[model samples]
Every structure is written in C-alpha cells, then in structure tokens.
Target: MTITGVDHTPEVLTVRWQDGAATRFHAIWLRDNAQGAAFRHPGNDQRLFDLTEMPDDIEIADAQIVAEGLEIRFAPDGAVSVFAAAYLREHAYDRAPATPDQPVWGAELGRRLTRHAYDAVRDNPSARKAWLDDVTTDGIALLTGVPAVEGKVCEVAELFGFVRETNYGRLFEVRSEAQPINLAYTPVGLNVHTDNPYRSPVPGLQLLHCLTNAAEGGDSVFVDGFRCAQKLRTEAPDAFALLSRHRAPFRYRNAETDLSNRTAYIETDETGRIAAIRYNNRSAAPLDLPFDVMGDFYAALRRFSRALHDPDGEMRLRLEPGDLVTFDNERVLHGRTGFSGGARHLQGCYADKDSLHSMAAVLSRKSA
Candidate 1:
C-alpha cells in the first residue's frame, strides 16, 4: 500500500491509500487506539489507559511514511508511536465491515445449512475453524454427534467466546412443562422470532443442543428475518419504511423483572444496509404511536410478519438427540411445531457475536 496524501491537520490525520480512498483518523482517536503491547495489554488485548489520560487537542507533530509504516510523534507530550499501513487500514472506522457476502435464505436453507461433526469440532482445530466460518457466513450451522451430557453447550461456547448469562441463567432448558414460564417451554408451536427483544442488548448467537426429541410433530423451524425485511422493501416500500423507522415497544415481564425497550423492527445503517432484525411478536407490547400513525405501523407490521411466517420461507428440520443447532439470533427467527405427550428436551444458551468474530480473526491471522 502507498500513501498518496498525508494531511496532518491539528484535529485529524488524513491518509490516502493506494486506491485513493482516504480515512481520516481523529488525533485523539489515533492516540487512544495506539497499537503494541505498550498501550494494550498483551494478555487480554484491552487498552491500558483511559481517554482522560489523553490530551483533548493532541496533534500529530510529525507523520511520515517509514518502511511501509507511519511513524508519528504526539505534540506537547512528545510520546511517539508507529502504526503499520496494513493495521491502520484494517482498523479504519470509515471502511466497511469485512464480513463475507452471504445471501439470505428461507426454507431453502434446510438443504444448504452445513452440518459438522461434534467430535471433529472438539478434537480438530481445522474442523472448529471451518465450523465457525460456516456459522459466520451462513448465519447458522448444525453439529451432529454431540455428546449427550449436561453443560456440553459450554464446550461449544468456549470454542469462540464466553457464554452470555441472562435471567435464564448461563444456560436454559427448553422442554415441555406442566406450567411453562415461557412459551418456549410449552409444547405449542411458536411463531418464528428473535430471542429477548425485550433486553436492552439482545443476544446475537444462540445454541440449541437436543438431548432428547422423542416426540410427535416437534420439528424446529427457522425463517430469515433479514430476507423478509428485504422482501418488504422491494414489494412494499411504504410498509418497510414504517417498520424500519418507527420504534416499537417490547417487554418481558414476570414476578422478578419487568424489562422493556423500544426499537425499530428493522435496523439499517446510514448507507441503508440491513444491520439487524428484531422481530418478536410474543414479546411485543401495545404500540404507543399516535392514533393516526398506528394504522400505518400495524399495516407495515402485518406485512413484515406475513413475509416472515410464509410457509414456503420456513426451514423445517427435526433435531434429533445429539444434534446441536447454532444460529444468529439477529437474522434468523426460530420456532417449533407443537408436539404430543412425548418428551422433547433441548439445552439452550446465548453468546455474543463479537467473541465469535474475534476468535475467527485471530485464527485467520495465524493461518495467513
């Protein structure tokens, strides 16, 4: 990479790459994001200093291309740092996310969702990496041959990142009960939806390992919420706008807590790229929009819901004992068909996507 231009402004440092694309980094941001083991801990890779330790108007006194890296000196303090061209480019906030291009799928995903062996993922490094890759790109993957043991979900969770404990505890049980606290605990079929929309920051990745599925009509269902949003945008732009722009309230209330939040069903970045989908009909509270706008919101919401629950769009798969299913909760809505008197038990847990991506990045760097 070649630096075509270097504008050392007092506020920001603008560096243009070989492709003429420039990323302007605020001097303060650059100083805070300093690389190496000096500012960041080698163990956890977390910053060792707070922003209060940095000068508000810190300027780059000197910046020059040196051996494919940029050597810099901060003004006043004279603290120096070196940022590699590749590192700077990779960490550039202006650059789009490097996530791979993955097409959204519906029922058709049943055939395409790749399956991996639990033993291979646990025993082989390459197998684990490949499994993560498929989950990252496809938004879901299945693992057969999981050992039928309690807390085996943690083994899968630790492979990428730590488990995200919720009010449901670190891990939750999904089985038919006499008096179920959540709909998921009942034998009735659930509408395809994201989990915990009522939480301020909902879980990203979810793992469901079946320990027992000896039941009648208990097949799992999956629908692509992102695809449904895109379909609404293409077919009903007005409805899409209503669902994407208006904030809807979601609540999860019980004896212990009354968690609530208002969020858009469809979230888009500034560039209009679909960032996430939060669809949970069961947890949705009554809309608080004005009387005039409520009609439009409901109309749009119905359209989006219809698109998500379309029979042809659902991917039906009956998870047997020892079958572990993992999915992105933000993009994929999961449900199940009501079962008879037979027992159906599944161990479920949540993990953040940040950890999964961090593991992938580390492994990728090592491989390269």
Candidate 2:
C-alpha cells in the first residue's frame, strides 16, 4: 500500500495512506520506541534494540481512540495493543506528563500498621471503644489493669481495636537514669504537645503505659485541643487562619535517625471542618507568616496555649503501675508535670488511625 501524507513533527503528526484516509500520531511514540535504548537501560548504558532489526512486514491495520486512549491493531502479526492515554503518558509516550502527590499514609507505613493490628496479642473491644471515643471527643483516656508486657504497646492498642504505630516505634521507653526501674526521682513534667507533627498521617493514637510509677512528681496532663481550636475560631478567626494556613517545622533527631517535617497547627478537611491539631511547643519551629498578621497569630496562639494550660480545660491524673493511658495524638495535647526527684519509668508507642478505625468497625459489626 502507498502512503500519501505524514507529519514530521516529533510531538504530533498526521499520516495518510493509499485509501486517502488520514490519521494522527504523537511524537512520543518515536521517543519511547521499544527499539530505543532509552526505554531499556534508561540510566545505565545498556543497548536495547536496533531499529534496522524491526520487520518491515509489521503494519498498522486499524487505529481508533476510545475513552481510555488510542487503540491500535497490527496487520501481519495480528497483535493487538490498547494504548491508554494514561498508560501512554505513564510510559513517556505523551506530551502531557503525569505526576501525583504522595499519599499521606504510604504503602510501607500502611502495611506495617495493618500487620501489627492483625497480630496483636490481646483484644479489648469495650476499652478500645472507650479509648477511641474519649480521644476523639476529649482527647484522652485512662486504662487500668491491662496486662503490660516488656515491649507490647500493640497489645494495648489491639484491645481497643488496632494500634497505629507512627514514626515512633511500637513501644518507647522512658525511665529516669537516677530512679532506674523503680518509681523514684523521675521528673514528671512534660510540656503539652502533639506527637510527631512532622509525619503526614501523624499517629492517631498515643498510648503511655506505666510499668512502674511510684514516683512523687509525675502526674500526667491532658488538654482538649479541639476545644481550644473552637475558642480560637470564635474569638479570633483571622489568627486561627494564620496558624492553619502556614507551615511550621518540627524535628525529632536521634542517633539512629533524623526525622523532620513542616506542617500546620490546625488542619481542616475539604469543607473547612477542623480535622487535626498539631501543637507542640518543644518541637515547634520559629513561626513564619505575613508580617502584618504575625502579631495576631501569636496573640491567638498564646491565648489558645493559655486555655490549654488552664485547669478547667485539662484533665489531670497520676498513672499508677499497670495503668495504660491512651490519647488521641491529633486532638489531645498531652504533657507531664515534672515528678519529684524520684525513680520512674514509662513505655510509649505510636499507632495510626487505621487501627482505630478497624477496632471501631469490629465493634460496630458485633453490636449490629
């Protein structure tokens, strides 16, 4: 068959054959030819194929565009291939390239948390539900008499539903060097703050288990961040906007790893509903915002901070050994009042929202 017209451009092309019917082709086809080495050993210098080796008998039998992409059938070989617009773009065979943002919960984090939830040692549905509701509404809950293993915060979370292990490990240890394992000399003072602001899907649940708490000074504190946020929204909407719109950096560095992230204090959903709050004075980086609004933001931030520290808004409790205290890392702000110079030790862990959701699902199903 004779060919009459063909466009020579690299990106878009028009072709006509013996039947005087014209068809268009994109230049990406030539650039991504299987016969080219670019598609084979992309970064390395490996040779892919020689164009001369392609059989001349191979010819296009039919071509059409469908909702998915271009469909093409080869003649002599009777081979068929559907070139989806998205697939072609993915293969670097389209002018418009495609790039998507990374998901909040990546595959690795998702898989790890799912496995941990499924393999939990102990399951506590009612307690898990209470823990979930308390954290969701008020941000904190105190669990007592749950068996504590050497390194199994997952078991505690599993009893509630599924524990979400965040960037923080399954179980974190906090024992004073002076007091050792006994409950003495360990300072109980901790600043109110959310855990791991740097993580996208910050751990939804934070569980602190008191293995030995005979210390004098270590009472735990919980602040309702959502309440504080609502106060800000009502008193100073502009300041709230500044905090929610701007990104603040957070860092957690240790010998094994150096993790850091920039995020906002108040996060909202698509409909502008308050979603999560990340307020950690210790981890907060210097505030950055429009010069004119910086003052107002700080003023509002100070007010919210003050409200969080207020006795009326906070729940204070001393965790005894064998007590498991869990809170919503997203909605509850937690801290410690420095303990007496006595001995004290606590173990902590990070688990994600999925586990909590799983636990909720199981309970709902059983109840239904």
Candidate 3:
C-alpha cells in the first residue's frame, strides 16, 4: 500500500492510499508507535520510553508524504516520526473491527475432526503448522500414532510449548485410584466441564494422551463451550445475561490445597465477544449471589448446563491407544464415560495458548 495523499489536523493525521482507501492515525498514537531507535528498542521492538513520559500537549505540526511512507513533526517537541504505509495499513483501526478467527462448532465437527499422525506433526514443519492452525481454529485437534508410553503427554505438550505445572505436577494420571482425591481419578462418568476453574489463571490448553483403553466402556466427549454459550445467548437472552454478568464462586480443597476463584460462567471481552467459559459443577462452591438474584442465577445456570449437555452439540469418541487430543480448555468442555472390567489409562498436561499462537505465527512466516 502506497500513500497517495496526506492530510492532517492538529490532533490527527489521515493517509489516503493508492487503493482509494483512507485511514486516520492519531498524533499521539503515531508518536507512541514511532519505529525509530529513539522510540523503540532495535533488538526487542519494545518501547524505550514510557507513555507517561510523552508530553500531553503533543500534536502534529506538519505532515508530508515520503517515498517510504508518511512523515510528521510533533508540535511541542518538534519530534520527527516516520511511519511506513504498510505498517499504518496493517495497524489501521479506521474500518470495521474484524471478528475473531476461532470458529464455533457443533457435533458435525466430529465427522471432519482435525486429525494428524504424531510422527508427521513432529517431523514435518508444514504438518506442524497445519495441526497448530486446526487447534486454534476449531479449539480441538487429534494426533494419532503417538507412542503409548506413560508420561508421553509431556512430550506432546513440548511440541508446542512447555507444560503448565499445577497441584497435579507436570503431568497426571487419569486412571482409577483406590483413594482418589479428585473425581477424575475415579471410574465414573463426568459431565462435560472446563478444567481447573478455581485457579487464578486457569490453564489455557490441555492435552490428553491415551496410553491404553482396554476398558469395557470409557469414551471421551467434547462440546464446544463457545457454541453452547452462543446458543444460550440466542434462545435465552436473560439466562445468558445472568451467567455472563454475575460471577460464580469455585473451589477445590483437600489436605494439601484449597484453591478458589470467582469468575463469570461466560466471560466476554471488551468488544462483547465471547472470550471464555468456566463451568465445573464438581468444583463449584456455594452460590454467593444476593437472595433476590439467587433464583434467577440458578435458572440461568441450569439452562446453560442443559445447553452443554445437548447431544446434538457433543462430539463423542473413544480415544484409542496412541490417540492424543489437544484442546482449548477455556473454549471446549470435555468429559469421560465410566468404564470397568479392564485397565484404562491416560496421561494429561496443560499449557497456555499464547505460546501455541506464537509458534503458529513463526511457522507461518517461515513457510511464507
């Protein structure tokens, strides 16, 4: 994109590109984003000075179209800043905001699950990039042919990022235990739920690798929590409002730890887009809402629970030996069916989403 013309007021600078599209950049924002060595560190691209260090009365004294981009002079300090047209176009906020790329899905996603061989993902860069993209786009992906070894899930976690250690340690077993502290260690069916909502910063991503599944019946289930929240928003607006506006208390207590957190069941970003879903009946604490709002909150919670339980919205699969599933813990609700008669073992670990996104971007750039 090339700047065709330049226009400026005291507070704003508008650049018209050759494509006939115009974009406006605030003087202060432009100053703050200056790419020169004076504004940003050449090594890390971080700001060298604080925003508070900037003069409040800063404004654009003059603007001119340059061969590389646009150049402007600040009024108060006469500081010169040059902005490349490409950079301006890339960071422009003049048009409608783009929607988030994460696509919500239903049961149909089961038919076309994002599946790849573990060897391919580990050995091939293109496969790795696509597998990561699938995880980000659909909030879930599967890798087959992983070695059915104990603690192998940690290796899978390192494929994208480091494992997020919690009270469960770096990794945890999912088989039945004689004296299980968490319900997950028992051979009982669990309702679909997000994991570890009581933690201050809930784990973003999770990986479960099936070591063996000779059990009678233990199938894995997943539901797109984002899809369910959107359904609630459409069919039961009041219920959606109650769940999104009010915070719910969650707790996990045993001899060693007593973690607690309070957050909305459905959280939205500043732009009102669904950001996360934290629903775990097992860890949920007593309702702390006012008496007047208690009934309404319960109704809303039940309605949302039913939405999560809807069979048409769930993707059920019996993860076989060597099958590993990775998913966004905040956007996808996962559960397991009860099994008996034989041994069923799986190892699981957690990792954040930021690293996954970072690797995805780098891989993309390399391929490009």
Candidate 4:
C-alpha cells in the first residue's frame, strides 16, 4: 500500500511520488473544509466544487509554492484547488469506512433529537427548557411549560426564531371545522408525511402546538424517513437508485390557490449523502417517466410507504395541552391518528431550516 505523506511548513510543499511523478497542492481546499464556521458559512466562505467529485479527474498543473501553501492549477478545468500544509497536517483524510448496512435510526435518531432539543430552548431567556433530548431521531423536540393558548402555535414557533407563514406565505388556519385550507376535510387522519410537497422549496420545519387534546386517538406519529430510505437502499438497491434518480410530481390546491412541484424521493447533500426524504401520498401527482420504469417506481413507492406505516417502525406520542412538538419537516414524516368526537384543537406554523440553524448557532454561542 502506498502511504500518503504530510508535511507542515509555512509554504506549500511539492509532493513527489516514488514513481517520479510530482504535483503541487494549495491551501484553498483545506481552508474551505475547515471546521471553523468562518469558512463554512455562506457569505463569508470560500466556494469550491462538490466534495464528492474531488477525487475524479483531478491533476496538478502549474505549481507555485507559497509561504503558507502550494498554488497549483488543476488540469482540464484549469481551476485552482488548494491544500494548506498546516491544515493537511492537522486533519486526516483516512476516515473510518462507512458501513453500508448500518442502521441509522433508534439510537442515532435519539442523539439528533437531543441536540435539537437542547438548541431549541438554549436561547430563550424567559422560558424554562425542560425536554427529553431522546424524543427520537426524526427531529422531534418537546417544549414544555409554555402557556397553553388557543390558536397560538405560531407564537411558540416564533420563540425559537421561526416565522409564522404557510408554504406560500399565506396565513393558514388549522381548525376542526368544515372545509380546510387544502380542500380536504378538517380533522381527518393525515398520512405520515411532510407538508407542502408541491412547493419547490418546501417548508423545512414545522411546529404543532396542542391547545386542547381531550379527544382520543389524535396522538402524533413520527417516522425517520431517512432510516426508511437507508433500509430501501440496503434491501432494494435498484428501487432506491430509481427513486433517487427520478422526479415525482406533487400538487396541492384549494378553490382559491394551486401549487405544484417535482422532487426526488431521496435528497442528497453536496457529498452525495442522503439528507432528506419527501414522501406524501396525498400530495403526489401523476409521475412523468417512461412507462416501463413508472410501474416499478410506483411499486417501490408502495413498498417504502408500507415500511413507513408499519407500527414497528414508528414512534408515537400524544401532545398534552401545554406541549409543543417541533420537527424537521424535510427529514421527518409526521401524521395524526384519527380522533373521535371531542374538541381536539391544535395550531401549527411553518419555519425554514435557516431560521432553526440560526437559533441553534445563537444558543450555542450563548452556552459557550
């Protein structure tokens, strides 16, 4: 096995392989991947190509050894990719090989749930943030002790830096009365799914607060859609790949408004890591694909949907009057069980991921 060598110096190093091949790597790539937020944030960060594509077709061209690192021209594209000597020495590229069959739910879910729970309340000065960080990995955070009020779920969401508005920025209401916003009857049992699949940029997070839950059988349900996707990848790789490669249409319309969009079942980050899952049977419109693959796609969708709805694969909880459940709308699938006759009023609001992340950062700084 060939061992990669690392050198630490003020200037970039000229690496020469035993095969008599030489190339100069600069500091730009190292600086961009820095753990510090100074290089990770949007406005203040350096721009680079997708990380997953880094190894492919990369070759060093003209090289300039600088005081801090090497300035090398990348081949073909002639783009500059850098590697800082100090940064290279500090970081290791040999990450533990990822286990393809590892389970991503359960304990892993608990950790993420806790982190979100901690960040959710670590900011509010007036509120007492008492929550179980192990609510589930599906991004559910419970905020307790908030004064229960009718039609004030938006207020609770606001405390966590979430703005109150619908996917379309229209003021939407949640009621048990007739004729709901989506033309679907109110208080019906909604499938475990994300909201506003029709919007290009679907709302990232959702907050649902219980004002009154005296009625029975309306307990909230959550499922880690990412976990389900991982399972699909393991058990049915072809189906998983097909879903990830194709786009499915989603639509939502009321008499007054109509919205639609197309997105894949598996969403990936810059590193090709699966980041989110948006599955909603109610909002799914007719898919546009070749007839042969369409049948298989629907079959795969059915199988995944079955897995999601399985009782063994879900986490169930009942929100009390003072309880507020906040979750990542993109990563978690949420639904309500059928409730019988009684006043089970709940109010909800939508917020973007950016706001939640901002809240987490502010809280982290305060704690720090």
Among the numbered candidates, top lDDT falls to 3
- Listed per candidate, the RMSD to the true structure in angstroms reads 3.2, 12.7, 1.6, 7.5
State the C-alpha lDDT per candidate. 0.87, 0.62, 0.92, 0.64
lDDT: the better of candidates 2 and 3: 3
- Give the 10-residue window scoring lowest on summed lDDT in candidate 1: 94-103
Question: Candidate 2 or 4, higher lDDT?
Answer: 4
Off by over 4 Å in 3: 99-102
Give the backbone clash total of model 1.
0
* lDDT (10s digit) by residue, model 1, range 198-240: 9979899999999988899889999888788888988999998
- Ordered list by TM-score, greatest first: 3, 1, 4, 2
Expressed as tens digits, the lDDT of each residue in 59-84 for candidate 2 is 56565555545545555545445554
Q: Candidate 4, which ten residues in sequence have the lowest lDDT sum?
A: 126-135
Taking all chains together, each candidate's TM-score versus the true structure is 0.86, 0.60, 0.96, 0.70
Q: Distance from true position, residue 350, model 4, in Å?
A: 0.8
Query: In candidate 1, which residue ranges exceed 4 Å CA deviation?
Result: 2-61, 74-77, 92-102
Enumerate clash totals for all models, in the order shown. Answer: 0, 27, 0, 9
Error of 3 at 81 (Å): 2.5
Judged by TM-score, which candidate is best?
Answer: 3
**How many clashing residue pairs, candidate 3?**
0
